[model samples]
Target: MKVCELERSLFESFPKVDAESWDHVGLSVGDPDSTVGRVLVALDATADMVRRAHDGGANVLLAHHPVYIAAPDAFVPRSGSHPQAAAAVFEAARLGVS
Candidate 1:
């Protein structure tokens, strides 16, 4: 299945509206057009989780917690802080984690 298709399926069941108004839900990275044969579900979208998904041959990483709280531009590379968020984005981009 494609990433977009999986997203649709998930939304059909979970329904993004069920999340709190302040919650950040749904796809956090990668491209929806990409093909996804396997999926890894977790509570957080951390760097290690991203790596695990890639190593496990999964193309999508679905999480309950928000991966990125601030804007993508706010996460400066190697800024000491926001390391996890930055790494998450980098790994997702490099490995195509959606």
Candidate 2:
């Protein structure tokens, strides 16, 4: 299935409306139209998790917690500020893993 279809299924099971106003509950990265080969579920979108997902042939990485609570001004690896999020997002994008 496509990423959008999977996202729709997830939202149907856990409606976005049920989440808090400040919660980031939807897709944080990747193309909605991209085909999903596999899914890697985790608690956080850490760099290690992204690597595991990519290595395992998963096109999407479904994480309970988002990479960042708020969008960072820049996604720079080892930026000192929000390093984990930055690295995760950067690696995911680089490797074509959501």
Candidate 3:
């Protein structure tokens, strides 16, 4: 399945409207058209998780927690309050993992 297709399926089952108003619940990185070779579901999107996904040949990391609650002013890896999230987002994009 493609990233966008998986996203659609997920949202269909757990509608985005059901989430808290302030919750960030959607794809935070990667191209929607990218094909999903494998999926690694995890509790969070950390830099380590991104590496593991790449090592395990999973182009898609279906993490439960969103990378950020709100969009960052800039994506400066390891230089923010949420360093892990910043690193994960940067790494995911660099490694071409969705």
Worst 10 residues of 1 by lDDT: 70-79
lDDT of 3 by residue, 1-98 (tens): 78999999999999999999998898889999988899999999888898899999999999888877877666656664755677888889988888
lDDT of each: 0.80, 0.86, 0.87
Query: Which residue runs of candidate 1 sit more than 4 Å off their true CA positions?
Result: 72-79
- Give the TM-score (vs. native) of candidate 3: 0.90
- Count residue pairs with overlapping backbones in model 3: 0
Cα lDDT tens digits for candidate 1, 10-97: 8999998898887777777888888887889989998789889989988888888888766455433435665578878778887778
TM-score of structure candidate 1: 0.84
Q: Estimate each model's TM-score.
A: 0.84, 0.92, 0.90
Error of 2 at 77 (Å): 2.1
